[model samples]
Structures are given as C-alpha cells and as structure tokens.
Target: MLESLYIENFAIINQIQIDFHSGMTVLTGETGAGKSIIIDAIGQLLGQRTQPNFVKENRDYAYIEGVFTSNEKINTLLDEMHIPSDTQLIVSKKITKDGKSSIKINYRSTTQMLLKTVMSNLVDIHSQFETHQLFKQSYHLQVLDDYCGKKLSILKEKYFNNFNQYKKLEKEYKQLKNEELSDEQYDFYLSQKNEIDELHLDDFDEEEFIKERNELNNFEKNAKHISQYKNIMDSSKGMMSLFKDGLNELASIDSSKIQDLHDQLYDAYYSIEGINDDIYDYLQLSNFSEERYNEVQDTYFKLNKLKRKYGASIENILDFRAELDKKIQYFENRESVISTLESKLKTNQENAFKIALDISKLRQENALILENEVKEILKDLYLPQVDFKFQFEKTNLTENGMDSVCIVVSTNVGQVAKPLQKIASGGELSRIMLAIKTACQHNENNTIIFDEADTGVSGKVAESIGKIMKEISKNQQVICITHLAQVACFANHHLQISKQLKSNDTNVKITILSDEDSIIELAKMISGKEITEQSIAHAKQLKKNNV
Candidate 1:
C-alpha cells in the first residue's frame, strides 16, 4: 500500500507531503484547487513522464517520491536490483528543465520502466475512466484467465510447449521436401570427392614427381650425350676395354704410389660396371606410353579441381565431405520424425480446444452471476429503472477461450439495454464503473483511486456511491477526490485541499481532517457558501449511518 507521497515544484503543490494509511482516504476541495495535482504527483512516482512545465519558476527540477510497504514479489525484485528495502521502499523521480527524467528505488538509482513494472503489482488505482475494463471483451478474458489461476497457468505452459514442438517439426518437414541440389552441382561434388578417394596415391611430392618424370622422358638423349663425351677421353672403339688396358698399364708400375693408383683404377672400373647396369635398366624403364602420360595428367587436374572446390588443401576437402554426409543423414532422419510429430500435434490441438471450451462454459455461467451483481449495485445508485446486463457472445478461440463481453445499459425500463457505450449517461458511466470496481476490488491486489467519482451525483445516488467506496475500503485503500459532502462523510480518513495567498502568490495545501473538521467540511460542501445547523446535523447523521 502507498505509505506517503512527497511532491516538490509539481503544479500548485510547491512542496507537499501527504501521509496515507490503509482504508478510504478522501481529498476534497473547490474545483481547480489542486486535488489532481496531488494525484498527478503520485502518478509521476508511478513512472509517468513529465516536462519542465511542471517545474517552478525559480526551480530547475521537479521531484516526486512515494513510500510503499514491501511485498514478497517486490522484495525479491529489489534484492535483484541490489536496492535496500529496510522494510519501506522509497521510489523517487526527478525531472530536470531539459525534460530529462531519472528514477530511484530505495535510494538506489533505477529506470522508469522498471519502476512502473514493479509498482503495478503494488497498486491498482481505478480512476472512473478505467473501471470499465471488464466490460471490454479482451479484459474479460484476461480476468477469467487470472481468476482460473494455476489451472490456466498450467494450460498456457502446455500450449506453448506444444506450439514450439509443432513449429520445429513443421519447419524441418518443409526443408526436407524442398531440399535444393541441382543435378549439375551434385555431379560436380560427386566427381570431386570420387577423384581424391581413388588416388590410392600415398605421400608423393608434386614438384619432385614432375621433375622425375621429365628426366626419365629425356633419358635416351642424356645417355647419347654422356657416351659421346666419354669418346673424347678414350678415342677408341671398345671404350670399356681401352679404359681397362690403361688401368693395367698403370698397375705394372711397382712403386707404392703406383700401387695406390692401380687400386684406385680398379675401384673406378667397378663403379663404371654398376653405372652401366643402371643405365641399361633406365633405358628399358624410360619407355613411356601416351595413355600413361595422359592418365597422370588427367589425375593431377582432377586432384587440383577437388582442392579448389572444397578448399586449398586435400585434408580440408576430406573434412568437408564428411560434414556434408552427416547433414544429409540428419535431414533424412528428420523427415520421418516430423511425420510422427505431426500426428501427435494434431491430437494435442484437439485436446487443447476441448480444455479451452470447458473454461469458456464455466465463464458463461459466471457471467450471469456477475450481471446480477452489477444490477443490484446500480439499483442502489438510484438507477432502479435502469437496465444493465452482462452480455456474452461467442468469439474466436483464444488462449483464454471464446467469450465476447458486452456491458449493456438502458436509462429506463422497456427502453432496451443497448451496449454500454451507446446508452450510458456520463453520470451512469461513473456509477456503473463504481459498481464494477466494488464487485472486483476485493479480488485484485491494487489500490483504487477515484478522481471525482461522485461528480454530478446527488441525493441518494451520491450516498450509494459513497457507501460503495466505503465497502471497497474495507478490503482495499481507496483515495477519492470529491466535492460531494455525502462522499466525504464516508471516508475512513478525510483530507481537505485549501488555497491561501502568501508572499504575493497563490498556494494550495492539503490537510487531513479531524472528525469535527470532516463534519464541518461536509456541511460546507452541502450548503456551498453557507454552513447551516441543519446541514451539520445531516452531515453528522450521514457519517454516523456510514459508520
């Protein structure tokens, strides 16, 4: 509940603090005496945005603050924001001349959006303008959903899970049927992976392999050049025999130096023998076929193409092939899974519809009960001949089910109760709103603030509205701004807004009225410029009767 509201440089309230406790608190004054200024200050602390116009002539800013007793949900949230509650929470708002707004909760700086979200749970102020929420179809559905409590909460969770599950399956099924791979692209990928896989080609260096092949292809020409060059050294027909004879002649010298030279010549002859055998093998092996050359050239091109398609490396190409294979396999499996989920989803949708229908059926019955309650309250508001009814029609199947709501009203009997918007007088709208607030005020967790709810109402009608506010105050704190003496008489606490001239300026101030003061104010409100002994007596009786 709101503990107190503090305002500075807010409209006519230069500086004011109104301490409030639980129950009916009434603010009354002559028109334009700043009753709304106080309420607007509280609204600002509830995260209403403001401009520099609200600031005083000499001040650079307007400050509004409210203190609220903590509840469990708000406490948990404050702890999350690291705000210290210390039993009472102080939410303060500051607006600078530049229209910049800042907020603080429990003295720790905060955001307006966060403040508004948290404060909503703590107060449900129902001014006359907002009391027709239940008369709107969507608000009626929300009310039923909230009233259904855990049953509706559980169903909502179940429905969402089912919705996501169905959407996932549907998405994959669509992708599966529309899996796009043109024939040309498929052929390209197939050929690339196939070429690399066939290459039983183990670790071979490309540069070295090309060089070796080139040398082998020129082996015959190289052999002829080496032979012709060796002919210059020997100048004989049998070159090998000539070379051996020259070695034998050298060996015939018997000195130690000659012996060394002869052994070196023998080793040279053996090396030549090995070289001769190697050359013969090369001559035979170097015979290359056009088909073999073409095969090597084709394979090199194929391997290079595979490298370019997948990546710049053979290893990355292999990895890409494996990943694509896995994706294809997953998509194939998803196809079957979606078929299974589709059947399950169809069944769940049917069941969900039935559950929603059952909830709507209950609301249909409850609507009748609610209509009678409204009629009873309206009759007390001196609308005995008025027609009011809760009309329920079928609507689309929504998350909360299918019940359209209409609040129908007629000013007199047999005049036909048209939809509320068409027939309700401004006074009747205010009274009808009061009736609804009184009916549901006991259930919601918000405070009700009435801004001149009793305006234009008089006599018995004014008394009934006052009594209704009193009854609502039994369970909820109701702050009403009023001019009616009958309305002021029923307050658990009375605050009177009065104006004074000071320092060449007009100022408005609010005071909490004592029992005697309340009766006097009530008398003043009833008789206007005159306070009569009879008016006081009537005010006293009205107060006593309200008690």
Candidate 2:
C-alpha cells in the first residue's frame, strides 16, 4: 500500500503531500481543480511517459515521489534486480524543462522498464482510458490466467519450453532434408576430393620450393664465373704461382724485411687455391634434374587450383573440406536422422498438448466461477439483466497455449451473449473492468487507483460503483478520482481539490476533509456552486446511510 505522496512544481499543484491509508480514499473536486494532475503524478511514479508541460509554468523542474510499504514479494524482486532498500520502497520521478525525466527506486537510479517492473507489484492505476482494454480478446486470456493462479502458469512454462525445442529440431530437420545431394552431385564432389587427396602436397611448403627453383636459375652463370676465376689462379704464371715466386724472391733478398711480405704472399696463395677448390665442388653439385622440376611444378599448380576452389590459404581449404564432409555424411544418413527428429518432435508435441489440456481444464473451471461472480457484481451496478460468460475457442499453439478467451456479454435477457466489443457501452465496460478487478483479486496488498472510473454513470448506479470500490478496499488500498457526490460520499477518506487565484497565478490545493468538511464538499457537488440546506442534508444523509 502507498504510505504517502509528495509532489512539487507539478502543473498547478505547487507543493502538496497526501497521506494514503488502507481503504477507499476518494479525491473529489470541481472541473479544472487539477484532480487529474495528482493521478498523472502517480502515473509517472509508475513509470508512465511524461511530457515537458508536466512541470509547472516558470519552474525549471518538477518532482514527484511515493512511499510504499513493502512486502516479501516486492523485497524478493528488488533483491533479484540488485536494488537496495529497507522495509519501504520510495519511487521518485523528476521531470526537467528540457523534456528529460529520471526515475529512482529507493534512491537507486533505474530505467523506466525496471521501475515499471517494480511498480507493477506495488500499484495498478486504472485510468479512464484503460476501459477500452476490456474489448480485447488477448487481454481476456491474460485476465483469466491471472485468475487461474500458479497452476496454469507452471504448465504454461513447460509447454512454451517444449514448443521452442520442437521448433528448433523441426528447423534443423527440414534444412538437412533440403540439402540432400543427387547421385551426380555426390560423384562430382568425390572427384574433387580425389584430386586434392592425390597430391600429397601437405608435406611440401610452396614458398621453400619457389626459393630453390629460383636459385637453380642462377646456377649456370655462377658456374661459368667460378670456372674463369679457377682457370686464372691455376695457370702456371697465374696469381697463385706469381705469389709463390714473389715470396721466395723477397725472402732471399733481405731475410728480416721480406719475412712480413713473404707471410702476406703465402696467405694470398692459399686463399685463391681454396676458392678454386670450392668452386669446383659447387659446379659438381649443381647437376639439375628435369624430372624433379616437372614434378615440383605439377604439385604446385595442383595446390594452387585447390586453393582457388576453396580459399586463399591452406587452413581455409582444409576447413572447407571438413564442412563438405559433414554435408556428405548428413545426406548419407538422411533418412535415419529425419526419422529420429520426427520421433522427438512427436514426443514434444504430445507433451505440449497434455500440458495445454491441463491448463485448459483449469481455465475452464475458473472461468465459470469468474463469470458468475462478475454477473453478481454487475447486477449490483444496476446491470440486472446483463448476461456474462467466458467463451473459449481452440487456437493454434501460442506461447500461452491453444486457447483463446473472449468475454461474452448480453445487455438484455433472452438475448444470446456476444463478444463484449459488439455489445458493451462505455459505462458497461467500466463496470465490467471493475467486476474483473474485484473477482480476480490480483495484486493484493497494493494500491489500486481508479481515475474517474465513475465517468458515465449517475444516481444509485454511481453509488453502487462506489460501494464496490469500498468492498475492494477490504483487501487493498483504493484511491479514486471522481466527480459524483454519490460516489464521493462513500469514501472512508475524502480529499477535496480546489483551485484559487493567488497574486495573478492559478494554484491548486488539496485538503483532507473532516466529516463536516466532507459533507460540505458533497453538498457543493450536489448543488454546484450554490450549496443549500437541502443539498447539505441530503449529503449528510447519504454519508450516514453508507456508514
């Protein structure tokens, strides 16, 4: 239940704090007294979208916050969402002049989605416009499911999971069956595989082979140059012999001076002799084989062809081959795989149907109870001859199940019930929504606000609507914004909203009325601006009778 609400700089409501309690509380005011402003502020706390105009004129920002008493369900949800809190939940909203808004749950900043999730367990605001939701068939199923409680919910969870698995397997089976290859295609793939497998090219590195082939191109020219150098050094009067003769002559001329020169000449002669021997060895080793060259060329070309067919690199080509192997294997065992998947799908289908059947039974039983209760409530709302029923039809499997629910109604006796959309007026729809809310008993121990729920009814019917709201308050908090005195007189707590002209500015004020003040407010509602003795007496009598 909501403990209190504090709003500042919101529209004409400059600053106000309203204390809420567990029972029916009604906010009654004249037209243009800013009653809906309070409802809008509460809606923002529930994470509804806000506009820039929501802030009061000349104010930079607007602030609204609600303090709610928490329960175990709310605490558990907050813990799961990592939101910090104590025994109370504080939901606040700030709207700036720039049309940007921020929401906070327990002073921890949160997104609108999270705030909505939290508030859903805390309050339900049934604005006047939401009565249209009663005409939707899907909404009917949802309401029915809520009324059925955890039994249907558990079965629905299992059914949806099984349905998802069945869909996945069906998709896989169809894709594999579509990919079955013909005999000719299989033979073509086999031939390509053989061509690549026969090469044995994995043992060879193409880069290294290219390097050796290029080196072979330089072999002949290199050998010719080495032969010329060797012939020069090995001649009798060549460099080696000349060096040897010089060393001997220099040694004989001067023993000490020529010893260093003789050592240098000896080193030069041996270096030239070593070069000649190495060149000769290299020339002998340069014998090239045409057969090996042809073999290397063939293997390199075959590998390049395979690379072009598959990918640019050896690793990519190998991965492609693995994929091909999977495809071939799948087609080879196509019938067996399909049969297996079909069996699994059948089992899943059976399981889904069995669970759906159980869920349907629960819904059918609950629908009858709900329908009778709604009819009883509607009877008190001055809809005495109204016929109400829950119509269920078989539909294809959906996330919910194989049932589609529609609320059927008939306004007159002896008439067949039809879908509410075809029969219910705005007033009837509002009463129906109230009936459902009262019957379902969803969201217990939380605030349920009706923003002008008594829009299109008057007289005793309006009083009856107020009585139903009061009864609903036995289990939850009810806050109603209404204009009818018949409804406002029945509130356990009465709040009167009034507008005043203060210093050339329009201001709104809310006062929690005492019994005497409540009677005066009701009299004003009964007689408009002119409150007379008769209206006051009538208002007092209305309150007295309800008490």
TM-scores for every candidate against the unseen true structure? 0.67, 0.73
Task: Note the residue pairs that clash in candidate 1.
Answer: 124-446, 124-447
What is the Å distance of residue 100 in model 1 from its true position? 2.2
Q: Compose the digit string of candidate 1's lDDT tens values, residues 1-547.
A: 7888888877666888889988889999888888887887788877776777777667788888888877777888888777776667788988887789889998888888888887876776556657456347566556544444566567666655654555555565566456665666566656654666675434646676677557545654676775665564435656777888988888788799888888988998989877776755664576656576667667677767877877686667667776555344544465565566567667766666666566666666666666677778888898777776666777654544556766677888679878776777778888877776566554433477888877678888888888988888877778888888878888989998987778976677888889999999998988886999998998899889886
Number of backbone collisions per candidate = 2, 0
Q: Which runs in model 2 stand beyond 4 Å of their true positions? A: 181-329
TM-score of 1: 0.67
The Cα error of candidate 2 at residue 84, in Å, is 1.6
What lDDT does the true structure give each of the candidates? 0.74, 0.85
Error of 1 at 83 (Å): 4.7
Give one digit per residue, the lDDT tens place, for model 2 in 320-438: 77666656666678777678878998898788888888888999999999989999998899998998888989987767878988889999989899998888888888888888888
State the local distance difference test value for candidate 2: 0.85
